[model samples]
Target: MPLGTLDRDPPPFFRQGPSALSKLAVCSALAFFLMVADARFKVMQPLRVVLATVLYPAQWLAMRPVLVFQHASQYFSSLTAAQTAQQEVLRKHSLQSQRANQVEQLSLENERLRKALGLRERLQSPSVAAQVIYDAADPYSRKVIIDKGMADKIALGSPVLDESGVLGQVTRVYPLVSEVTLITDRDHAIPVLNTRTGARGVAFGDVSLHVDAMELRFMAANADVAEGDLLTTSGVDGVYPPGLPVARIEKIERRVDAVFARIYCVPLAMVAGAGHVLVLEPTNAQIPARPAADVPAVVPRRGASR
Candidate 1:
């Protein structure tokens, strides 16, 4: 096999079918014609399907790079997304743990407060826990509905409380549902007293003008009340028992013409936003408490120098 013979043995480039440009032009013209035929009439539907079937393997081969890139990108994206979700879950768990610790501390402080006030240990009113289903239909009234109703012994005028403080009073009762009026409603009135100065007042909401705030009316202008004072039920009203938390005084103003000082309060408990609540059922008897002992007189100590 001489080199020259080998070179001449097979024509270096044997003529094949059509030239690349000619083949491309013919394919393009056929595709355009087919598209036009399909658009103009539906007669080419079966032909198009058969053509697609014949070209399926080539089409798949042409798209291999794109498919591979898509799959790889998706894998990396999924890994990053999974990491982000895991971090979010960890952060939420940490926040919940912190909240739990704070709740425990608040419970201890509340117990200490009850003991110091010489106030009878407030009997934990027996309550039926309920889940809030929905907000009141009427926008004018600040009310909510709960899952527990007459079936659970929940009745009208029963006080509802959350973990933090008092939420509202049940106004309506149904077979399996109950409606509660938040303390922030205009028509709603609650007897309240200042925890710091012992000043008594009535809390009323003006639904027509104010929604988030309540008014404490009939407070004396010279009353020793201040902002941030905790308002509690005076128990004067037969409806709500005494010493129940009502609201926290946020602002106080005295006007020359007005006879009483104006006090605004924000409800301690979020009645509208709460998910769970306790319906406190009234008890027949008062809470039991030990009588206070009299203070003994102190004698002066005898000292040698004196």
Candidate 2:
């Protein structure tokens, strides 16, 4: 077959269709029109819904692995963060607890110091502040050893006082320590004046009932003693200072047949819990010496003249 006679164009059955640009332009115009119609007239909305519903299961299946991977990563990260946050919270709580304990201890110590300072300021006589060193070795007597002694000028029979009231008296003074016999001791005694009635009475430590207490022995049955009466030192013994608190009347028993009344008193001082005390000079040492003019002259005998 001659080259010119060969079919340059495809036979009618195999003829080319419209150009790609024409097809593209027609499809774009149709797409624009459809979009406008959908926007304005709700055209193709039902079709879109139907297509989405039908393809939903396939889309979900395709996204499952990606969603799972993201969820797993997030879960691990959140777990680590939660553990860290818990540890931080625990650490903060521990620190706060420690600080609270320290604050409480400091508050208690400050209170004790304030009480001690106030007691020192109210005292009239010279005093040396002393701490309780240890309890006395003799268990038979209620006695305590103080840190102050002869080295600190703590004299024998010196009055000891706490913040509340009189505690005891220094009985034995060593070079560095002194032993104080508490007012509740079996051998201790103090002359006390009734604060409410102004009646004088001698308070003696009594241990007859296996309990330490002060008793006003020999008081008349009709005495004006009553419970809750405050007793103060009378300063008649030349040992304790005047106007110091001694004890408070706890009980009073008066029988019709008995001549004396039984009065029990509780000491105001913190005998068992006293941590610090004031040791004052003996009141006897403060007494003025007797004047020479007050001495009486001896009388001469007149028998020789007779």
- Top candidate on lDDT is 2
Predicted candidate 1 versus true structure: per-residue lDDT over 1-51, tens digit per residue: 767656545564666568899999999999999889889997698987999
The 10-residue segment of model 1 with minimum total lDDT is 112-121
Q: List the residue pairs that clash in candidate 1.
A: 186-205
lDDT tens digits by residue: candidate 2, 1-306: 778888677688765788889999999999999999999999999999999999999999999999999999999999999999999999999999999999997787577667767977877778899989789888888999999988999999999998888899999999999999998898988889999999998888877643657887779999998999999999889988889998998988999999999998988988877878889999888889877786688777988664
How many clashing residue pairs are found in candidate 2? 0
Question: Alpha-carbon error at 261 in model 1, in Å?
Answer: 1.4
**Each model's RMSD to truth, in Å?**
23.3, 9.2
Candidate 2: regions farther than 4 A off: 1-106, 208-212, 293-306
- List the global CA lDDT of all models: 0.79, 0.89
For each candidate, give its TM-score against the true structure: 0.53, 0.62
In candidate 1, position 66 carries an lDDT of 99
Residue 47 C-alpha lDDT in model 2:
100
